[model samples]
Target chain A: MTSYIHGEIETPVGPLPRIATKWTHLDRWGALKTRWSVGRMKYRVRPGIYAVGNPDRDSRVFVTGNFKLSFDHLRRNLEGLNCWILVIDTKGINVWCAAGKGSFGTKEVVRRIRIHHLAQLVDQRKLILPQLSAPGVSAHEVRKMTGFTVVYGPVLARDIRAFLDAGLKASDEMRQVNFPLFERLKLIPVDIFYGKQYMLIVPLVFLALSGLNPQGYSFDLALNSGWKPVVNLFSGYLAGCALTPALLPWIPFRRFSIKGVVTGWFVAVPLLLAGTLGISLMEKVSWFLMMGGLSSFMAMNFTGSTTFTSLSGVQKEMKTALPAQIAMASLGLAGWIITRFIFI
Target chain B: MNRFVYLTDVVTLELDVTKCTGCRMCLVVCPHAVFGIENKRAVILNKDLCMECGACAKNCPEGAINVKSGVGCAAGIINGLLRGTEPTCDCGEGSSSCC
Candidate 1:
């Protein structure tokens, strides 16, 4: 909550517990640090400016969203660099998310610069911002409003030092956004956190029903209805958040939703085939319907992550897709219920 | 232009040609290259490509441009609708639950 300037710290040296710079195979330490970091940043965000190191008037100033996870990751990766952290009031949203929402935008950035009187603190009229933020903020407008030149930095803050040292030039790789395993893994918790309640509630209800009903009927009921729902939920969430982001470019299809649909199909086909091989025709049909619905619904969830689609386009999509999804889910549920009661 | 079913109506996207100063700012900033300058004036050669990122609107000095811009995602929109907020690119809606 406390905002800080550059000179507050007594030591010029940075904090301990450095983020591992070496790219290694995912291990216990990486997992531990990631989980701990995500937990610690659980929306502990207050919108204000922060100083990364003991920066003087001459040091560089970098702009970012107030999301603690984004802020922490950016600062932790700075290591020994002296810089001013100008956090815009993005309501604790990360840069990419905020940009998509227009919070990490031209108006907010300009407004923050004025509100904080950033001109007085820094001698240079330059601000290093995340390149992804370009979609939201107009560099020309920022300069016109705040008299500061907006320099789009690397996509990842971890590469800030390298970028800064290299005469404020970003390499091609730095400019490209990569959703490798670590990046994809980090996003999973956020997705889960948002959907966990819905996820847990549905399953628990089924579990309760399974316990209450007669042995064969209840067991059959739970297995028939509950298992697929739970599986679909997991499959959908993973498809949208994990698989969509991780295998972004390689997933094929230009639209993000299509990419997610492809991933969902990959998951669904295997399961459907497996179920068909082992189960009755009715069960197989139910599985097919459930899988199709789950994949489509999850694919729909991915419209937000892609570079394509407009707000109007998305609205039009929701108007069409959401109802269809609901109908599919409803039909799937009805099919499952009928099968559970009559067949089993 | 051959009408595509998915494309928003041409009338829905009104580009005030009079307000345009022919700076080509929109032409350069647009990721999709939606706008193309013919002579001095900018024209929407492919509005379908518009993701509505607001790069054109934000940089437009004369208040000449507007488009429905926001996080074009189903989850983001659903979250917005549930909150009774009109979706157009304001991420933090005074709650941690929101994006």
Candidate 2:
């Protein structure tokens, strides 16, 4: 009775890495995309109850939104903790976002609880939830429906151990949400990813416009023509994506768009003044229009990240500000073209 | 930090004081100091300075806070809107399709 041995698997005595091999720091587009058998993080996951730690009926249960990133962060941070992790699919969005959209609301929690047979698995009717999951989850409603008392956990998963140790209560600092420089910076990649889409289009349009000139401009002129628009495009990108985010808290403004505009203007000032020193009126107007367009356009983007803007507020801005910026850019393009053919 | 009031009157982030509790959580978390204590309750003193990160709402114990939380970038919002769903980017909302 010789049993065939499978390939020898290398082993380490120490605990395996807390994170799965797929987990990595979030890139410019949120967490980097993964190709695994589990179908990756952001996919629409099946809703169910999972165990962070196997336990009898007395183990504590934690509730989380089904957004894979949220679940991943929680599970990764939990490390050695033993508890039952209940995940309610909010259609693959994080707790905070799901809460805002109501996918993480009371009915879903109760439904998941009943569907997952949570009552039979655990003796206690307590569920620890991420603090940000409150918007859609009506505590009163969940209690009425499922009889489980909801205890709000800290904003970050790293503090969960301390919270459970302290009698299921969040410490003062645990309750506070800090948007530190690194935290704010973490969002830059997503911003850059989205911005890149627009960035790709803007320059291409300007390049075509440069070649549209009928005066048969020299190759040097055509080549140089793109240089300014390129600078303008980068300046605008920096204004909205990099500068606005990095200096967010200190930008001396309320509306993110306005703050973005101010930031763009600040960067644009030196260049604008420098470009205008000996340039013609056509160039000067074109420069001003470009600056105005880029500044406003960059600032307009600040609406989504900042605290001051509203849905209606942003819509209104897009309505009024967008046209103005586009008009300015068009004016600049028109002026540049006219200067190329009619005047210069 | 008080360089210019660029966001002045551009956006309004208001907290319904009737719903507020003096948790003092918003105080510690805000990067912009947009909130302050007034008579034991949190007030949006510098409301215009808010980045709408949903941190205060998340930390508020009473469920009394509300905010339009999403990305502050234009491209992010436009992209969200084009998808025909809510635009929350705490990695929480369903932007997983973008993944």
Off by over 4 Å in 1: A1-54, A76-82, A100-102, A105-111, A134-189, A207-266, A272-278, B1-50, B62-65, B82-84, B88-99
Q: List the residue pairs that clash in candidate 1.
A: A101-B89, A304-B73
lDDT of 2 by residue, A70-98 (tens): 77677776666656678897877657656
What candidate 1 keeps of the native contacts, as a fraction, is 0.50
Task: Give candidate 2 misplaced runs (Cα > 4 Å).
Answer: A1-46, A196-198, A212-214, A217-220, A223-225, A269-279, A307-320, B1-99
CA lDDT, every prediction?
0.63, 0.62
DockQ of 2: 0.23
Per-residue lDDT for A272-318 in model 1, tens only? 65553125576555544555566666666645545555777777666
Query: Least accurate stretch of 10 residues (summed lDDT) in model 1 chain A?
Result: A15-24
Native interface contacts kept by each candidate, as a fraction: 0.50, 0.24
